[model samples]
Target chain A: MIEGRRAALPPVARLGDAALRLVGEAGAMFLFFLEAFGRIFRSWGQFHKTVRQIYFIGVKSISVITLISLFTGMVIGLQMYYALAKFGADGFLGAAVSLSLVRELGPVLTAIMITGRAGSSMTAEIGVMRISEQVDALRVMDINPLGFLVSPKLAASIICFPILTAFFDLVGMLGGYLTGVLLLGGNSGVYWYRVSAYLKMSDISGGFIKSLVFGVVVCTICCYMGYFTHMRRDSVGPEAVSQATTSAVVTSCVLILLSDYILTSLLF
Target chain B: MQANTPPDIILEGLTIGYGEHAVVSGIDAVLPGGKISVILGGSGCGKSTLVKHILKLHPVLAGRIVVGGHDIDTLDRRGMHCLRQRMGVLFQDGALLGSLTLGDNVALPLREHTRLPEKDIRERVLSKLGLVGLADFYDYYPNELSGGMRKRAGLARGMVMDPQLLFCDEPTSGLDPVTAAELDQLLLELKKSFEMTMVVVSHDLDSMRAIADHVLVLGAGRVLFQGGLAELEATQDEYLRRFLDRKAQERSTPRLTMPPLDQKMMKRDCGKYLDE
Candidate 1:
């Protein structure tokens, strides 16, 4: 009888229902993020947990971030050198590579990389804790699970994202120098001059702002996915954790790009 | 920091389930203070659901639950936390944090709730672990411990706060007989030593017989019996008799009604791989 009723519903109704659910989930996610973020200052003791998370989410991610950033910079340098060489404006290679990295690729790629590396783990760890009842144990012990588990991650992400973006931008400029000046035999002085002269405080600050927003977006979506793993209707237990982790990574990456566009439009 | 007597839990017309669908309803019972009240049932009879409702892990679906004279529903967030500080729960399979050592896991409650020095916290943690015979394995992670040890560690963490009320969900569900019996003994020891109100949710008849001071038997979404353990054991109700005696109900139909699978439908057949 229930199946028949559900089947009898019109496609438009079904679509509306799905749309409503999406809106509801967005509202809930916002509230969840607010509660967790607000609790970052709930206690002096949370300082230690935040620092530990920084070691895990920030310091541990440094090596991967470095590797990816260097390669990303190198690729940009090579591409820009060739593109500028066609127009005999290869002197602008540094400006092209540095601006693109700082304004776009640096924040976007760094976020995507961290989402794969750290954000996915955040989801899995919390999802496991959720399924295993460790989160409930915290609540029963009079400890808020949000304050204990997620606020630290959020704090660490906010701190790490911009710093990592800055690092990526700098390394990418050097990569441009490696290709444009050394490999392709362009004048090093002109390339360096273009990079320093074209880059402005507004561009740097805009990129910083983008990274910060991406940090909140990634952390919020990933943590929310894990925290609600048990409540997922499609699966249960370990499979649910896996699904949540996948969803966290996918959602964080998508949102990073989506928010990057929105922030770019607004900031620039 | 122990209460002179752990407070009684009062459940009035309580209905519990995941959502609108009710698993158990109209449950009215008073779990007395300073006694081990075991909630007995068959598998999936909403024993754990009731316990979760009482713990405020899930919202009360329909009725009122009063813990120590305070209606749990009326308590604000701060009030709820204050109420929860007086209670502890041991989940099935321990639920110890994977990231922390057993010692740190046990010390979590104290470190979060109290301003005690590290030395005092360590001393208290060691004492609790000692009570559970896990003092020597303080540095071990939860995965490194056996099932019984993890449960014992969970118990130690539950007790570290010296909570007035402790809830243990299936403390003896998945354990060897010897280990199960040892846990039962530990519960008895804790009851005798601390005099805290302990609500144990389990289907293990032996564990109930060994440790239950008061018994509440739930079946078919209602409280079938609520009283002394002897009274429950003495009851002659048909369902109760079948449950207590571990007798299977006589079925009117054959247990297996489905036809066997057709081997000819297989996408890949390799009859030579097996001896028919």
Candidate 2:
């Protein structure tokens, strides 16, 4: 019956319907994020759960973040060295690499990588729990499912994102040093000097702020998608869980880039 | 701790369903306190949906559900939590937290609601697990256990709170005959031992006959019958009689209309490998 009704609608009406649904969903997601965020402080016995989440979301992510950041910095160092050498300005390779990473690339790339690694798993795990009635079980037990599941994740993300971003920035600069000074025979002293000279407290703080925002955004969107897996109109059961995980990863990445743009404009 | 006289669950013209679609409507019944009341129905007849409404998991689309003198719709968040703390629910598949051991799963409510010492909590958890004959398996995770074991573990978790009211959703649906009989016996024993109001939703006639003091029969989007098990068994209404007698409605078409497999459709057939 719903399919028949939808089929009878004109193209314009269907478009409007879709737009309205999008707005409604956005509102729901915002409210879900608020509730989960607020529950982080209100719920009891969260320290252990938050610690467990930190180990999963932060500690376990160290190797991947290290690998990605190193490669990204090396690529930047090599590119900037060639570009600067044209003008005998290779001494500034450190400035270019450090500035770009500390200001933009570090936080953005780390968040995107974490979204792929941990964010997708969060959605899949919670989605399975929702589909299997484990979430409902929590509700019936007088336990707020958000507090029991999502809030600890939110708390862990808030703690982990900035620390990881800082780690990424440091490792990424070392990667630049390895490529520019060690591999390319650039002046090591000049590279180190340029890195320290160009960076400021604002640049580092800006990156941290961006990481914090991205962490909240990714965690919220992923958890929200999973929490409402049963309500997805496109699928049901295990298929719905798969769809939710995919949607969570894609949406978190897109939102990361989009918010990075917005925050860059405002912060810089 | 059980109430001296557990409060009855009263549903007045309750309409239960998913959003914008009513599964069962005009459901009026009383699940008496301290008795095993079974909500009996076949698949998709809204037995579970009715239970969800009564448990306040789903909002009633119409009318009211009063549990233990509290109107569910009128209850605030704190009130709802307070009310839920007094109730326990065993989901069909146990619904144990995958990350926690069986002991921790049973110990969850105690840890969450009370500031009991770890030693006392562990002791109580073991006792509940023992009641379900799973004390030896307290270290096991939900995935490690068989379906019957999972259901029993779920029962243990449900009873850990010592709730005044307990709800079980198809507790024996997927179990084998022996396991199902064992669960039925467990429910009977629990009822005999505690003055708890028990609401079990199932279609198992044998189990109902074994334990149900009162039964609410639902079908085709409404309540079909609501009374004692004896009255339901003696029911002369055509549909109820057919249901009680385990009779399937006659179908005009053949049950399996598809033709037999065609070997020609197979990509690879090693018919020669089989004995003629």
Candidate 3:
């Protein structure tokens, strides 16, 4: 006996479904943010939890962030010196390194690092809670999972990311100074002079704002993915959480890059 | 929990599911106040879905659920939150927060909702833990506890607020029979001592027989039976009988018996192996 084969949907229909799903996800994220932030200013209950999150997401991440920033700064100093030497402008190494660190590398690299460290772990933590039915337990207890779980992390990221980025900038500049002056035989006086002359308030502020935005984006996306790990009925088993964490990390990285470009264009 | 009060929860033509597909539809039942009600069903028959609906986790797809005289579907977010405050739930896995100690886990609800002083909170936490026989295990983390201990701790946390109603999802699913019986006794004791309504979702016949004042049987997305343990025993429904028989089979220990290996069978099969 012959079996009947089924017809597939046209590409247009598939595209429409994808579009609708995207809209639904965006709407969910917005609603989740509204719920989490609504409780942000209303309670003292969250203060301790937020502090705990800051320690986890900010303080614990400091060493790694510092290490990466220092190396990045050194690489920039070395490459910039060689490039400027070609133009007989090697003296501008200080200004170049300082500008790159402040305007782009500080915020971008710090966010990327945190995304891998804090963001991924946040997703895993919440995802485990989801699988373990702890989130549901919170709901059953009349506690808003968002208020209890997501809000603290969100507040922590918002408060700590900018601070961490600033630290990254500071450490990075010191690294560049070490490479450009002590190692490369550049004049320390000229280096400091050029850095001061080239750096502006706008550049500093732009980077700070970018760091703030990236923090919000990373926390929101990662938490959103973890919180909604089991939204669908088919989402079951241990694998569901693993999938959510992967999706969260990939989505956060893509969003960071995309928004970075947009923020850069608007700010500069 | 008030004696002689109307049923704490009333469902009329309630349909529950994710999105458009109805896993359980047209569910109508009234679970009496201050009594233990057990929801029973085979796998995928939507017992958990119905429990979620009763908890107001998702929107009711198609009908009315009146809890404490208010139609749940009509409640706004604030109203829903307020309604939930009076309810406590014990998840299948206990759902204790791993980061917090057992003491802190029980104290979470109080910390979040009340302005009680640290001394008072600590006292209350100890009291709750003592109730669950975990008074000395306060500083232990969730992972540090055994499965039974974890469930007891989860129960302690659930009862922290002394909620008017309690909902337990498969409270004894993974436990050994002895442990399951212990949990059943605990449930019975809680029911008597706390004077709160209980709604338990379980497929365990022994648990239902032990603790259920009212039993609700669900199948094919509908309420197949709603009655007491005696009435369940008297039920003539073929599906329920089949389910009971299947559960009985599952509960029985396996015993293997080998066919006699001497004489005729050995002559026919063993000769080949022996290379005669």
Per-residue lDDT over A1-268 for candidate 1, one digit per residue giving the tens place of the 0 to 100 score = 4447656889998788779989999999999999999999999888999899889888898888888888887888888888888998888987898889989999999899889989999999999999998998898898899999999999999999998889888887887787778888989899888988999899999999999999999999999999999988778999999999999999888888889889999998
Candidates by lDDT, descending order: 2, 1, 3
By DockQ, the better pick of 2 and 3 is: 2
Error of 3 at A252 (Å): 1.8
Off by over 4 Å in 3: A1-7, A232-235, B1-7, B245-276
CAPRI band of model 2? high
Docking class of 3: medium
Question: How accurate locally, in lDDT, is each candidate?
Answer: 0.91, 0.92, 0.86
The candidate, 1 or 2, that scores higher on DockQ is 2
Whose DockQ is greatest here? Answer: 2
**How do the residues B138-231 of candidate 1 rate in per-residue lDDT, one tens digit apiece?**
9999999999899999999999988889999999988999999989999999988887999999999999999999999999999999999989
Of the two candidates 1 and 2, the one with more favorable TM-score, higher being better, is: 2
Number of colliding residue pairs in each model: 0, 0, 0
TM-score of chain A of 2: 0.97
Native contact fraction, candidates in order? 0.97, 0.86, 0.83
Ranking by TM-score: 2, 1, 3
Higher-ranked by TM-score: 1 or 3 = 1
- Top candidate when judged by lDDT against the true structure: 2
